[model samples]
Target: MTEPTSNKPFTEQTVLITGASRGIGAAIARRFASVGMNVVIHYLQSHEAANETAREAMRYGARVLTVTADLRSVDQIERMQDKLAQHGLIPDILVNNAGISHYGLLSELSENEWDEIIGINLKGTYLMTRQFMSAMIERKYGRIINVSSVWGISGASCEVAYSTAKGGINAFTKALAKELAPSGVTVNAVAPGVVDTAMMNGFDASEKAALENDIPAGRFAQPDEIASLVYFLALPESGYITGQIISPNGGWLT
Candidate 1:
């Protein structure tokens, strides 16, 4: 990564994103890159995809560092943090977007399934936030955006585990926002409605269409759409907004 020029806005500082190889994560990296903000793209098992994102960000004049680690383990996260530091990539903003979705009735869900969803969706967020948030507090200038789901706000049937994990994320966002406010570090969540991403591969075309029909917008959101909100929340002007779970559900749930 090239050194930061003598003159650059603090907001142009580095932003680290977990699970940023594709979908909303990729969109977010682009959003910051457009503004020349250095970005650290984190991915697990998507090294090739992450490198592609890195190159794309570099095209926009921002330094991009791509790293890999499973979010399920705190040790790996600590090591990942160290790798960023080695690259001179401490983040001024952190986007905790790494998570997996599990679908099944409560009666049919297995213990492993429960742990997988909870581990990545909730625990990973906590781990990443815990690992890097102290730096934010020390600087008194940072943005932490947690990418949650609409189901987190309104529970969904047949997706009990996923909903529970997201609900926990919402709670975390609210609680942490208050704790970090005094330090000038803002914490917020962007809960999105169904978007056209690979996560929806489980849904049949007909099921997707039916779900879209229920939305007031009559369509699903693009990954870029959700990324826009994440970018906006990280702005210097967004300091006053915290402890809030903002949902972008295409009016699906009022």
Candidate 2:
């Protein structure tokens, strides 16, 4: 296989992606690996799935590493940092793609449900960025991509928890981009309308049909399509394009 290109050229830069066992995360990992970029795929569980993704990424002749971390805890994140250092990997790009979906009446939601969703979706983003971002700042170059949802921009019925988390991510992207831009780091969000990923496992065929019908493009998005836009945003040419929430929804929401 032809090797994918590495975005971080000077150092053995790594792209750390959470929730990378499958779906959009897997696609993102493969895209970077195709260009021979070192990728660190993180997962909370699903060690098998994560390994599968790593193997696929390695096919492109790129270095692929896997780590398991509980996004809710700071100590686990710290351990992950140590593992990266051991591998001679310093992250230059980070993709905050780990999130959970919750669909139900807000009134019926339990406190634990709220915490889990917010912890993994919102808090994890914060922890990961906080942990890995300093290296980028020191190097004066970095890319941070937050995977958001169309619901984040526009609230979705029965999905308050998911929407809220994504909304927070959107805001975080904007705020952090400004904070890091002066240091030559760029932060952006990719808000996808709908993609055929396991996250949609909650939706039935009929519900998906309706969502597809509502979209002007008349279809759901593929993970690779989202990955392509992410790849573009990570490029050096994309330095001036920070603090933007870009949605590739096939004209669904717009």
Candidate 3:
């Protein structure tokens, strides 16, 4: 369909989502694909899973590409960029959804564990955004949507490292949004609450139910629900909304 009169048509634009092999990332790829938009799914080690996502997106006749790269390495990211350039798939929208979760007591957490969490969640977002944002700035029209967590807003107890990394993402979104605003590139973060993804595997059935009861909605959110919010933020109509951490956590946090 139709997009804002001021911007390119949805069919002509491309979206690149990092860590898109499964869960929220995959949901986002499918969301864009539903509208027949160009979709690029980036994964670290999920070749098969990425291909599966590509197949699903192809059902809507979207141009889909799967690229594997370690976001922690700039060299790999540069290679990924080169490959996309060869395919004429420069992204109009960049979703820094690639991240990892950490659950442990701060006392028990090793320095390496802390580094890994920050590297993937915070540093990876920074690297990916830095790599792709120049093209968007050149066009003076783009969307940068970060998939964060509600814990980022209200820190979690056992998930100190995860919370810290996501909190960094929240801050990054705010600061970068201002820098990119004059260029007509909007930057925002979607901090979702508990979702029914593998990220919740650490919690047992009883723990999950207890957590769900704590949420006003009485259930974990589905990945698609978060994807819907992301899709909205990427729209031309949402140009006015930037530098905001919009959390869809079923009223789990204000």
Candidate 4:
């Protein structure tokens, strides 16, 4: 595999991370920012939270901008792209980290619930990727990282809808990687297990402890840990690693 000609330094690269208002997305934004890369924090409604993350990122001396868009809407996404273009912040890296989770028996899941879950978790990734991929292909150098879940690989009993969406994301990552390979754009997914984010709030303390005990690492992964992995994947040296679904599950699924 031939590497793309290095056009810009890492410090000059720009990364756009969706759902970056908080949690893992925020961490990933900060991770990229620390290296002096421009960061675009995209949020659906968490404007205040997004600004908070932007402020934190700016402390690292990186340029930070926050954009709001409903990922489910193509028009909104286009508007966001226009805004970014106006600011000269077209992203060199795209991180599809915006997703929602659902927990319940498949039989108990309502149609609306299913659609909402699938729309945000799966369709949102598709829309964002479709919108931005052309630019990456034109530039011949880009990193597209999708934040996935361990449940996507090993089906979770209660999280059927969530698992299915992430599974689709995993598949999307792999297929797109192959399609974009010739263009020097690497596509990959980071599937994490039991992260200590608000997403885990549904589990009480005891439940959290039980889940932690099941992992050989004896603890849930910190957001920063996942962020660090994503940061590594975005590096120019990681150009050759594509079409891979890397699970950082702390020995939960080997």
Q: Write the per-residue lDDT of candidate 4 for residues 15-45, one digit (tens) a residue.
A: 9999999999999999999989999999999
Q: Point to the candidate with the largest lDDT.
A: 4
TM-score of every candidate relative to the true structure: 0.95, 0.95, 0.97, 0.99
lDDT of the structure predicted as candidate 3: 0.94
Clash counts per candidate, in order, are: 0, 4, 0, 0
Cα lDDT tens digits, model 3, 131-235, are 999988888789999999998999999899999999999999999999998888899999999999998898889999999999999999999999999999998
Model 1 CA deviation exceeding 4 Å by range: 1-11
**Ten-residue region with minimum lDDT total, candidate 1:** 1-10
* Residue pairs with clashing backbones, model 1: none
Poorest stretch of ten by lDDT in candidate 3: 1-10
Candidate 3: Cα lDDT at 110: 98
lDDT of 1: 0.89
| Model 1 lDDT per residue over 65-112, tens place | 888888888889989989999988888899999888987789999999
